[model samples]
Target: MRTIRVIGIGTGDPEQLTLQAVRALSEVDAVFVLDKGSEKADLVALRREICARHAKAGLRFVVAGDPERERRPADYAGTVEAWHAARASLLEALIADELGAGEVGAFLVWGDPALYDSTLRILERITARGRLAFACEVVPGISSVQVLAARHRIPLNRIGAPVHITTGRRLAAGLDPEADSTVVMLDADPRFDHLDPELTIYWGAYLGTRDEILRSGRLGTVGPEIRRVRAEARARHGWIMDTYLLRKPGAE
Candidate 1:
């Protein structure tokens, strides 16, 4: 039987790799990396750097070109389903062609595998097809949410209050009043400006790395500045990973 380890390598810092992740890296016969294109070359480099830092010698590295997806299709759910199917097909082929019986392979995830990442989903699809036979193991890593909160020196939730974690799209629809604190991720839009000016925001981008940027203040005072800074950073780096926490006044 073949074995595949889905390991989380943390947000960005190489040192964030847990000892379990390090041991998993050492045992892998091959490491698979998805190339997202030249625009995000830094992302690919980070994965390679992690492998170089932790994996045992004589490790084989496989680089696969990621399938492009429609960014703004009319049917977002359908488009994502199709894209995932394509990715699963590609992964299935890679496993069959590259991994022999009893060999160990791995894919390093950017954050916790159970988070916003689709690698685990794709792997499940491949295994469910019954064409490839592999046992999978997961090793959790530090997530960007944890890193963001830690860097800001804040708790995710107020005392006995609930924290709502949602995407930028859902946030644009409406803010939940019951959620004392809301954490936003995958925010391509500046929806924070829609909230009351009295609300406070703590934001971070390119977290756990040298290029990290952080900002905090009342929404009215710092929202525009965050937007401007975010635009400049995206233009400079070709891509950005950011998250933020918002708190209503008197939320405790």
Candidate 2:
């Protein structure tokens, strides 16, 4: 039987690769990479760099075009399901063609695979189909959330209070006013503006890289700046991955 190791390569920094991840990379016969097009070519380049540094000699790469996802579909859940199905089909084909029995293959995921990434879910779908025969092992890596907290020099939770982690859409709908601290990820819009103006925000972009940007202040005063900076960064890089922490005053 073949094995697929889903290794988290951390954020943009090549040094974020864990020792275990390096071992996994060295053992893999092939690494499966998803090409997100030229707009995000830098991302693909980073993955290539990781393979170049850690993968064993003669290791091959199976690059597959990522399935396009609907940005604003009315049926968001249905659209995502369809997209995952398509990705599963693509991965299944790649594994069957590229991986031989007893050989190891890997997918270098950004951040922890158990986080927001869909690689593990897609792989589960492929396994459920029973057409592919491969065992999977996940090696956790530092997530952007951890990096954000570390860079900001703040704890994610407030004392014994719980921390709520959510996305922009959920944030726009609204968050619990009494909630201790809320961490927002995948927010392309300024949803934080709707929250309490007195709330504090710690924002970071392009984390773990030379282009990193950080901002922290009262939401009312810093919210607009975050929106502006985030927009300019996106325009400059053609892509951006940002996460922010919103905390109520005196919560800590």
Candidate 3:
């Protein structure tokens, strides 16, 4: 059976790679990268740089086109499931065609595989099919959320209060009053505009990289500025990966 390593390389920073992840990369015979088109070419470049820094000298890189799905589907979960199924199918073919029996292959994930990433789920789907047999392992790395807190010098939680992590789509519905802190990820749109004005926001974009942008203040004070900056950054870079921590009025 072929062995697949789902290694987390962290958010766009080669140095964020853990020692364990480095060792894992050294063992990989080939690494698969999903091309998300020219708009995110820098993401692909970063993956290449990470492999160059850690993987064995002769390690191979296999690039494949990522399947696209609706950005604003009526059924978000269903759309994502379909997209992941397509990814699983593509990755399965790549592994069967590119990897030799008993050889080790890898997918370098952004942030911890246990987070919002779909690589683990895609691998599960592939295993469920049982058409191509491979053993999978995960090596965790620093996440963008961790970087956000570190850059802002704030903990994710307040005292014993629980932290809520949610997507932009969910955040649009409402913030949880019971949770003292909320970390919002994968927000293509600025959904926080309608949130409580008194809340404080610690936001970061393209974190752990030189292009990192950070903003912090009362939501009412910096909300508009963040929206402007975020738009400019996205337009300039053609892509942006951002996350923010929101603290209730009295939580801070």
TM per candidate: 0.97, 0.97, 0.98
> Once superposed on the true structure, which residue ranges of model 1 sit more than 4 Å away at CA?
none
Flag regions of model 2 displaced more than 4 Å. Answer: none
RMSD, one per candidate, in order: 1.0, 1.0, 0.9
lDDT for each residue of candidate 1 in 1-252, tens digit (9 for 90 to 100): 999999998889999999999999989988888899998889889988988888888888888899999877889899999999999999899988888899999999987998889999999999899888999999998999999999999888889888999888789877898888898988886756568899899999999999999999999999999999999999999999999998988855
lDDT of model 2 at position 180: 86
Instruction: Indicate which candidate wins on lDDT.
Output: 3
List candidate 3 stretches off by more than 4 Å.
Answer: none
For 133-207, candidate 3 gives per-residue lDDT tens digits of 999999998999999999999888888789999989889888987888999999898856678998999999999
Top-scoring candidate (TM-score): 3
The lDDT of each candidate is 0.90, 0.90, 0.92
Residue 114 CA error for candidate 1 (Å)? 0.8
